[model samples]
Target: MKIAFIGHDLKFLNDAIEFFEHSPNISVKIDKWEGHEIKDEQASLEIVEWADILFCEWGLGNVVWYQKHKKPHQKLIVRMHRFEMNTIYPSQFDYHKIDKIIAISPYVYEEFHRVASIPREKMTVVYNGVQTEKFEKVKSSKAKYNIGIIGIVPKLKRLDRAIEIFEELYRRNNKYQLYIKGKHPKEFGWVWNNQAEREFYEEVFRKIENSPFKKNVHFEGWGDVTSWLKKVGYVLSVSDYESFHMAPIEGMASGAFPVVLKREGVNVVFPKDYIFETIEDAINFISENDFSTNNNLKTFVKENYSLTNMCNQIMDIFLEK
Candidate 1:
């Protein structure tokens, strides 16, 4: 099948590319209008119309804009990432002339229901897949501490909460240093809604500047997860709502503690007591918990969220037909 993904998002294009690498008969090409940038807008529209199936994500909004003008007939499978569908509001949702939907988490699908009516069969929940072969555990340095957070950082991510948690940890013992691998919002000081998000991110660099913990907060803008995992000593993801994803999964793949927030609906997959309620609690737990003795989470992720399991489940949907 000639599957074309329309997005600049690394996951939408890269993940599918990874699958195609392993897939026997599937042929896939991902472009959120690469030709448009070089040639003309009409040139990009040609690719979308030609594709057997279209996978739209991240910058799909850009294509939807063209849909208003060009009227391309691409059977879209819109994939929702974590940041795109956090709230269930009319303004928040971006509508495309789509045939089916692919959500990285269930939470996004439910949010989609709030915006438009779609049958359960039409919307598929395909959890994020980790390239386990590349992101396995690394030897942690005992003397030098390296705590990290690996994901897109929006306000919902609660990276500040992670910082506070670390502050407490440092007060008790200053062994661990922190690395937060997310871009800070460019209007943190002003009303974020009023300021453009990218502009706000520009301001955030100035705000966090010259702070005491500035040395600890390392912002390595998005890159190779497998390579990043090797440098990460620990991983923290404290989001308020998740369909079921983000840093924790990648961290777990890399043998990080995979600290997540304690929310009510989390019991479906995550075991009891897996959620941490407070920063104080996380501080205390990490201070004493010996990771060498705790590879249980490591094993759980290996068995469940591995690449083979994720791809098999996705292929199951097409095969069922």
Candidate 2:
């Protein structure tokens, strides 16, 4: 089958690309275009004409565009991943404009129902997954009070919240560390054109560095996950909201006990083996546990959220019709 994938916020990596490419009888012709570069109407119509199946992410504009010009025989599938369900994707579009909808988690689909007419059978939960071999468990040397926060564009991640909790932890014992990876896109040479945002990040980074408990903090820029997971024993994902925060799951794969907040719809979707209510409670829980139980934790995540499982879940949805 000839398939075309449309994504703007995230570009699928090599593994994700290869996973889709190797699917049974699939001939993927990925169209790499962002929302900003979508000025060419002919380009979109051409893609719509070429694809037998369409996969889109968080782009309702594309959804409308596809509805306007998609071939009657082509299969349409839109994937929703952002936290804002009602605000981003409204119900009006679902009445006649779309076909299959893929959500990263069950909670995400529940949220999607707020504005879409998708029934349980029409929606599928395809969890965002990572390669277990790349983000495999590591031999953590010691259980320091280190916290790891990993993401690319973190508008809602609320790293400051994690910083505040760590500040409290450091007050009792000054051995804690917060290792921040990922290069700041708004800070480097790219900032030369957009100085205002650059200055804002400069202030943000400065405050993070001077955050009362700065001595224990370390700014380890972007690199491999295996190398950094060793320095952190626990992960704090205090984001404003999440459709599917795969970072915490990846952290779990690396043996770092994730102390994630119990999202409303997430409890039903993700296993309750290690979720905690508050940062304090999570801290206490992590203090008592060691990396020796990493295998069990990793196994739980691997079974539910690994790349193979994620792809299989999605394939089940595509084949359901």
Candidate 3:
């Protein structure tokens, strides 16, 4: 079958695409629409028309294009990641034309259901696939004191909370340092489209600046996180929300314990022991645990969240009669 993937989030789609492309009798193509809007109308329509199925990575204006131009026999599937749910775009999708809607997590499916009035059967929860091989690096001895956080631009990521937890750890022992893997919001103005988000970003910046442990804060710009994960003892996912946060799972694969906040759908992905409700609780947990020992976290992720597993589930849905 011929499949066309449309969206700006091609980076996240890499593993899934790799799995699909290697299968027999399957062809895949991707169109890069960076903004909320798709500027190349003719190219977008041509790709939509070429595919037997249209898989939109984000439920934004590109989905609207599919809603208008998708062929009668072609199946339209829109995957709504975390950020799109906050916008009005989900409501704007023409469900009559869409064959399936994939929510990356249960929480996102629930949120999409509330907005779209779509049938529960029409939507499926497929967790993000992580390249476990990339994260199988050995952890350095120095990693015991370094804490890591990935993806810093989104205010929803709650880097401020991660900083607070790191500060608490530093208070007990000055060895703790935060190594952030993504760009700050101040560096990417387009991420915070509204004034409210801009204000929230500014507040987080101020908090980071005013903190006494600011000197220990390291802003490492984005790239392949596997190398960076090797230098960290623990991975922190202090997000206010997530559809399916992959960093912690990746960290676990890299031999680092992942301390993630207990978000609405965290239980669906992470073990309860790794999910903490409060920063103080997280601090206490970190203080008590031995960083040198492995908890089989990598095995759990390998079994459930691997690229092959995720692709099999997605392929089943795509091939369903």
Candidate 4:
């Protein structure tokens, strides 16, 4: 089978792509877009023409383009993430032409069905999987008091909320610290260019600078998060919303307890014990640390969201008529 995967960002598709490439009777090719725009139309067109199946990694312009251009015999699958729902791209899809719509979480599936009126049978939920083996359980001496938040960009991630939680944790125990991983707002050209986004981040920076626990908060910037997870005892997901937040799962795989703020579909994605209803609830949970339960957390991730399980489910979809 000839498969072509197209997307603006292909990072999440790595494991699945590798799995397919090694499988018998399958050939894979990937075409990437330059951010939101098509990097090379001719190159993408050639891949589309050659493949028996086309997989759109994000429900972005690539999917819309593929829907209009693909031959009738070609099967097209598009994966939709949470951010795309807020954009105009989801409405542009011709549901009849799309062979399958893959939602990363149950919440996303319901939203697409309600907002876009897509048939329930047309969509399938495929929770985001983490490479459990890569994030081996290891920790520093001070890891028990450390909190980690991955991806703070695009204000909706709620970096402000994370800081608030960290501050309270610091008040109870001066040993507590926050280690943030990912790019700053200035690193993202689109965010930095927007006046509203620029001001929002400026305020976040100002709050951090003025806070007493400012020295305790560390922005580690972009790096291999798996290695950094060793220093993090708790992985925080205080986002306003999420389809399936992977940071906490990755943290769990690395023996870090996840303290997630309740989001629309978080309950479907994580155990109730890992979720927090309010700031005080999250602080109390972290304060009463039982590090011995870390093994159970790792087991949960391996059993439910392993890389092998995700690949098998996706492979079944690919081979389906």
Best by TM-score: 4
Q: For residues 1-321, could you state the per-residue lDDT of candidate 1 as single tens digits? A: 666656554653475467765677777765544421233556456755666655555524544543443335445555665455433422323355545567666666666566455456667777666666666656566512567876534555655577777667666666677776754454234325544544544454554464455666677766676667666656776766666765766776676676666863455445455567877776777787776754676677777667667667666654443
- Best of the two (3, 4) by lDDT: 4
> What would the per-residue lDDT of candidate 4 be over residues 85-144, giving only the tens digit for each residue?
777888888988999999988899998888877688889988777878788855898889
Better of 1 and 3 by lDDT: 3
Q: Which residue ranges in model 1 land beyond 4 Å of their true spot?
A: 33-40, 58-75, 86-97, 187-217
User: For each predicted model, how many residue pairs clash, with residues at least 3 apart or on different chains?
Assistant: 7, 1, 0, 0
Error of 2 at 240 (Å): 2.3
* TM-score (C-alpha) between model 4 and the true structure: 0.96
The all-Cα superposition gives candidate 1 an RMSD in Å to the true structure of: 4.8
Looking at model 1, report the run of 10 residues with the lowest lDDT sum: 85-94
CA lDDT of each prediction against the hidden true structure = 0.60, 0.68, 0.83, 0.87
Supply candidate 4's per-residue lDDT for 140. 91
lDDT of 3 by residue, 1-321 (tens): 998889977778987887788889999888888688988777887896689989898888888878898888888888888788667787777778988888888888887778666578789998888878888887888898899998976677877788789888989988888898987676776766778778877787687798888898998897878888889888998987777888888888888888988878899888888899888889998878887677587888888888887888888878887
Global local distance difference test of model 4: 0.87
Cα lDDT tens digits, model 2, 84-135, are: 3545444435535567777877777876665554676666777777777776
Q: By lDDT, highest first, what's the ranking?
A: 4, 3, 2, 1
Give per-residue lDDT, candidate 1, residue 66: 38
What's the residue-level lDDT of 298 in candidate 3? 82
